[model samples]
Target chain A: MKRLKPSLVFIFLVMPCSLLVAFTYYPAIKSLFSSFWNQGTSRRPSKFVGLENYQTLLADDVLAQILWNNALYALVTIPISIGLSIGMALLVNSKIKGTSLMRLSFFLPTMLPMIAVANIWLFFYAPGIGLISQIMQYFGFEPINFLGDASTSLWSMIVVAIWKESGLFMIFYLAALQAVPANLKEAAKIEGASGIQVFFDVVLPLLKPTTIFVAVNALINSFRLIDHVIVMTEGGPNNSSALLLYYIYEVTFAYRDFAYGSALTVFLVALLGLMALFQFKILDKKAHYQ
Target chain B: MKSTINRIAYSTLAISLATVWGFPFIYSLWAAFHEEKYSANFTWNAPLTLENFATVWAAAPFSLYFTNTVILTLIILASNLILCTLVAYAFARYKFPGAGLLFSFIMVQLLITPDILIVENYNTLAKIGLIDTIFGITLPYLTSAFGIFLLRQTFKTVPISLDEAAQVEGANTWRVLWDVYVPLAKPTYLAYALVSISFQWNNFLWPLIVTNSPEVRPITVGLSIFATVESGVEWALVNAATLLSTAPLVILFLIFQRRFVANFMRAGIK
Candidate 1:
């Protein structure tokens, strides 16, 4: 064991600890405590109205709609992106000509800023002048307002999320696919297994950890990444596309309702905490060394 | 014959999907270069012109935004490198009290990133008189938990023998870390640096909340404000500005495609 020196420890720990405490730990704890109080200003400093903020949270109709929107976003985006990423990995991993070009195209979106991507897609979803609408007009279909309609607004947001996300996740799946043992597939083939059979029975099971990793990370991402929403929809057409984090942003900044915003933040944190719990329990169970 | 047909079908599907994936960016490139009438026109023979770029350049303070982004990104990257290196060295080499607990606290940050605490962080920055300043934007990101974690894992992989050898050769702790650990973790440093640069450069929400003016706004916030507030501006001009904002990174990506992809893959595995 290395000898521990007091000065060395102090020198190293000072900056990291202070910053983490100031930004992450303190604010997180403060938000939890602040959730129990009512909003106040200098004239009448805040009062501890126990559970009142949470009570308001319970009755919040916008919160209900936001949660439903986020849930649908997570459920739909997660699985489809995962499946698409797997397919993308398989395509690139194959010996197809122009695989390098395909790989470049697949990963290009991962490099661009999500805000820029939103701006680019915004043109595509613009009413009659948009690309999709122009094509629809050529085919004689009526031009649909993709982002303006309440019914299709969230789905449009989902399409952008899937497009931006699946590319990055494809890299993860590609790495995992490359690590699958070649001889194992050969052995399976020797046992009369078809390519699809070998993949489902052999290769895919080995990729479970990667899938779980991508899934949990994608779930955390679903809540945090609302840049597109801000740029494209602003959770508009009557809060039809508002997400949990976006709602917290609006409540805290747009409305200046700190108490209620604190409650909403706590709810978001708890949802993330649930994801953490799922990650640990599930990852622990699934991690087995051969 | 059956296998040839299968191969042709799969290749066609792959190429078509790639086109869809690449279409938005390609369209942005097309619109940014051509006239407005051809944004969705798909005219192969349309005369290309730099008029939109000229208009966009005159419209916004994109040059200043570009400079601010460079300054902000460099400062954050430098600070993260220094601070995380020191902290990671300590965690990797020292046997100290509460080290495990402290390390776990840092790990907690990987999930509860500074991004999610935007409201509270804004309040904190405001109370401390950092709001509307570039320093305020830089403060929350100065020491990345992921950076420390990645470097710690990398430093730990540096065989203890090399560390001991460096110390025995009259190297001080700083010298030992610089000469032994840091050199050995060069790839991790490069990977972390690239990831951090892209992330800080592209970061929007927190910076958007903190910065209120053109003097301190990064490229992303500037682009967002430009795109949203200038609703009446033609798509061609907006797309031109968008392309301008993303040009540096995109150019670097095209030039260093292999290294960028490899580093991203390396970062992802951890």
Candidate 2:
């Protein structure tokens, strides 16, 4: 009967987690182990080189640039995306005309595949014949090669990231806005708080938990969402637009450098781990707020 | 009087912002309907044609890609539903040793994702001889952390009294779970399933790396490679292909936006 109980427990839990072991748990452990070794191909076994890959990654200029680009992507995309989300949510939440239309239009981008959207954006950012260039020509401004220039390429990707994230994140905020008690708002108004003051004093604090959730999503997406990079620029213009995940793709797949790619993956795992802790703190604050 | 003017200005600004958001798909739709020569510019008199879609269909094996995607999505959704329900039941009903640590470890996948482990996963898949197959593309995503989390939350809300009543009726643990928890969480399953379908349908990157042949490649990878290989000269065909891939989901969204919103809320995603 004791044996039967243990087996039942295993069947209940371990059997299910075992399915993920092949892809998630095992690969994570392997990535950790492989980062310490140099493995060239599937035929040969990896050699344990003791942090040689780490030294190479530290000195790698392209890795440094990719890291910077990712930080910039997160830094610029997070706040703007969150702000736009809140603003859009508030707009739709209001009893404005065509609110449903506006909400659907904003949310449409979330449904489209990033790869296909990147293809359309390619036309919008191309030189001369592109949509942006046509708009520029009408204003007598010089046509800019948005995707081809080293300076603007990264920014163009950032625009896509912002556009993609803002609409989806808006939905989360909209849900929270809808849940806020109408009586509370009316009470604040009765107390003579202006719209802005009421928003800051009542609505904002109520939306704090949702804000934390959306912020964490956007932060992680900024790091991992490199599909548009593959479609639009392929991290070109001298690697100016290369985010860390894209660099990991290029290194591991195109260059067949597994050790260094695993090193990059380790950095990504670390960043996400830090995010987990940050999220815990934020969540703890929410608990305290209650 | 000043307030009237301010209201008008706000309305105009909001409308323009909405227009900016919708402009890309609008352009794609216009180009998809027009002849290639007239598609390059806004010409009201341009002859509309269904020929671009036909051209796009013959230009790629999109039907095959569609089949592959559907099969891949089905396999993933089915496996996820079964596995996540069981695991979430264990999480909600049982108090096993080290279960807290295990749950936290599983939560790490919520942030890290198997995409980050692409390098090692590819190596592992190759060792198992699953490369270049639909199974290879779908394997990494089959066990979703989000699914388990969502279902666990739902299962916890199942009244424990009902579970105990079922146990008193001689139902075993498995029977209790199947009869009580699973039946109660059907709406949660529906909600989570839709979210999963929409995401896995449009998923790229890892699929692109794993599947090379036309037989196994999903539409996103297929469409992405088509754009790069054919270049920008055939915008009409490209737009038509894009429309083909996205139209179903957009229509689904339009019809079910309320359900989508409500389901997301019920999931308590935060």
Candidate 3:
């Protein structure tokens, strides 16, 4: 009976995971395999064309541009988002009245669905009477084409992304900040550490683990920058803001090229895998206190 | 005197920053409550009206979408809580073979999220004839590595003596789990539940890809149609529609604001 009970529990636990493998991991592997094949139609048999999809992807100028845009988007957004989040966290974590309300306000954007947020932000980016353009005009500057022109489109998307994500990351940093021993800060203060000095010398060092955690989370989210692209740009303005996931989505759905989309997926998965490996390695290190 | 100045400066900076962060939301609420045509105007002087909310509510099957979203989120949450707890218990307590390997495999799912695997996941759904269904949307999220890892960490903190005593009193593993571990891990469960619900509720991409028609489309997806490319450039109406779609969650967050923040903090800590 004892043996039977343990086995039942094991089976119950393992069943869902097995389903995960069959449904998720199986498709993941199949996707990688399918990338090498020309799965042309629903009825016709797919031909095995080894590395052809990859070769095609490499030589394709649009694909290259899309990849570059995605990389640039990640580079610009991740650091800015993390930096703003840290700043927000510091402010909200301070001994100020109405700190809770401030924190809540900051996080409000993140709580809304991305599509909803995008819709509102899109309105703000509108030309004639848009909030941003009106503000620019108020400041005696011409209304800059935020999401319209190719030159400014990707950066505009990055700005919107930073706005949405920084607050969410701030919550993580705030939680980590709360865990910091209050005595440490007090001791630093007694030692005549200036506010900035205390922040850099004491608080920043203590938040290293949090920095890593936030950075990794931001990295993963950076790759998942498809929804905003879909809702706002749709990879428009001459494919300037086309991110990887969005590019893959376009290839699969819009362009109807499943094999190439699968190839992009494989590449994206590989990048994410590398990121996960790096994150795990960093997390494995003993968290430094001093 | 210097400290007082510093405090005031920090407070000013914080409030301004909060305002900048929150202004769009205010704009959204205003737009949602204003006339549909007035949604385009960026003025703060627009008269407030609930007519836009009525239009958004009556335009399509938003109630159905909300019900679907709630149902899908709940199912995913319930399944995650149960399966993750069980798996976490095994990892926490048992000396089973291949346990480490199994746990690591589960962790891999975190790296390869639904957004990344949407294409293959869609194909998988098509193969299993679960396309355009709520089950399709929920299946990929059913076994979350974050939930498993969190519950495992929480379960490990429970005292072993409690489990042993329960076992000695003729209580089975399930009984012990229910009687001791579940009660002890309530906070963790609450934390995980909040995270899970928020994630599933705000989730857009997977649901967008899996479910085809309005019948199975979640609110997020339904909200997307209103913001579609063909829609007229009515910013106010779009923002109004957006606000209406997200109102339930916003209200819930406001009501349980403290608990929600605490839950997020707890989840992050773990």
Candidate 4:
């Protein structure tokens, strides 16, 4: 009993806590603090210039465009992917043969690295010698530069994002759809419910929990999975296709400006933190395992 | 008659959607194997060759990249598995003070992941003099919230009776964790490992941000550099490199897909 008491909890907990603190919490708090200061020079350390970074965030035009693009990205990709995932899941979840092969096709994109997928799609969107142009030429139409053009660049990357993420989301929907139980549907049919009616009446309610979970996952991914922007356009054609996180990368790494980057990161952290709080509110009692 | 029609319609829609999803992979295979001239066009008679793989191998130090990836991935996996297991056991079984707050802090990582803190993390790495090292690439990811959450869920499911049986036999805490909890959580381990390994193996932005030299670049980063437009894009060679970087996970998926999907379901993670 003595050996199993709370004294030994320190042994189990210390390492993981140190790691979490060092990596996640420390950087997060540091970024919050540093976002207020200017970057240090050789002789002088950083000095606090309160709200100046936030003011810059408001005044930054390219940053606004990038945030809008991210919002557009979320708007376009989330619902489309969720719809496609539920469809794909239902298709594979049915009592039919050859679903394994179909399941493979859907999830294959989910397997390949995001950067690799970006590379593949880069060829598809490349002008003149690329596949899309070749197809347009076969139809005697002039080729449009997809990624190089400002208007089309964001949408092209959005399409690639849809292709990459929908398949992965399908797996979750498939798991949930499979657990829906056949007898419920059979009972509905016996009660003279049509397929579509049975779907809305019976299936949708059951899928609500799953839909909420998938929505949250999809939302986070919209922010995290912006690697395509790095490979495809580098937020090019004059920052037309930039996203928030990728913009942070550009500011921090490419421009070597950590203070401003920290400000932008605070915005991202706040956005995600709001999302986590929302999930917590809805999931308070349901959250499992202490 | 209507039911039959509905079935056919659904089947057609499903098959076509799958084909649309499959087009890129099919194109990769065809474009990789065929001669460059016909790589863009689909034809039955295009002659195939292994030259692209050779060209790709020659162009980059993928061998070094592969070595770096293996080292970094193994280090992360070993560390995560051990650390997550210990913490998860504590969260599931113990009655420590500040446990709730600590668990919430860890769970907050799901939202504010290491990848999101790249700039500050770079500063952290620079301060510690680990920037550009392989260790730096993995420093922020050594302990994963998803792994801890997953293992904790798995451990809570473990019958308390088995643990007590081991305890009554005079097994110490670590021994009970090893002899009782760890063995029972094999499926969860495999699921978390697969996710961690595959994700870290293919992770680009962090490694790209942290590692400057080719010495510590992983295959995904290597692929990005190898396929840069400055080199005058050759479809065959680029596709070959993509396929090479992607093949291990693809092959593993093909073989253990059942285990993969099963573990995800059993572990209660999507």
TM-score of chain A of 3: 0.92
- Per-residue accuracy of model 4 over B1-270 as CA lDDT, tens digit each: 998999998889988998999998888888888878877777798888998888888888989989999999999999999999988888888776677898988888888888889988999999999988999898899999999999999998888888899889999888999988999999999988888988998899999888889888888888898888523578888888899889988897888898988888879743
Give every collision pair in model 4. Answer: none
lDDT (Cα, tens digit) per residue for candidate 3, span A1-290: 12324666545566768767865688789889999998678788789999999998788899889878978988888888888899999988777888888888888888888888888888788886777887888899999778889998998888888888998889878878888888998999999999899889998888888777777777888888578888888888999988888888888977788898899888888889887777667674743211
> In candidate 3, what are the lDDT values of residues B1-270, reduced to their tens digit?
998898888888888989988888887777677776665565568788876666666766779989999999999999998888887777788775667787788878777876688888888889889999999899888888888887788778788888899999999878988999888888778877877888889898888888788899998888888667323545555776787778788787778777766765664463
Residue pairs whose backbone atoms clash in candidate 2: none
The clash numbers for all candidates, in the given order, read 0, 0, 1, 0
Lowest summed lDDT across 10 adjacent residues in model 1 chain B is found at B261-270
**Candidate 1 lDDT over residue span A135-226, tens digit each:** 99999999999999999999999999998889889988888898898999999999999888998999999999888878977998999988
lDDT of 2: 0.84
TM-score of each: 0.97, 0.95, 0.95, 0.96
lDDT of each: 0.87, 0.84, 0.81, 0.87
Instruction: Summarize candidate 1's per-residue lDDT along B1-270 as a digit string, tens digits.
Output: 987988999999999999999999899999999999998788899999999988888888989999989999999999999999999898888888888898888888888888898878888999999898888999888889989888887788789998888878999988988888888888788878878888888899898889988899999999998887763558998899988998898787778767766765664463
Alpha carbon deviation, residue A19, candidate 3 (Å): 2.2
- Candidate 4 Cα misplacement greater than 4 A, ranges: A1-7, A43-45, A282-290, B229-231
- Model 3 segments more than 4 A misplaced: A1-6, A42-44, A286-290, B36-45, B229-233, B267-270
What fraction of correct interface contacts does each candidate retain?
0.67, 0.60, 0.64, 0.69
DockQ of each: 0.65, 0.57, 0.58, 0.66
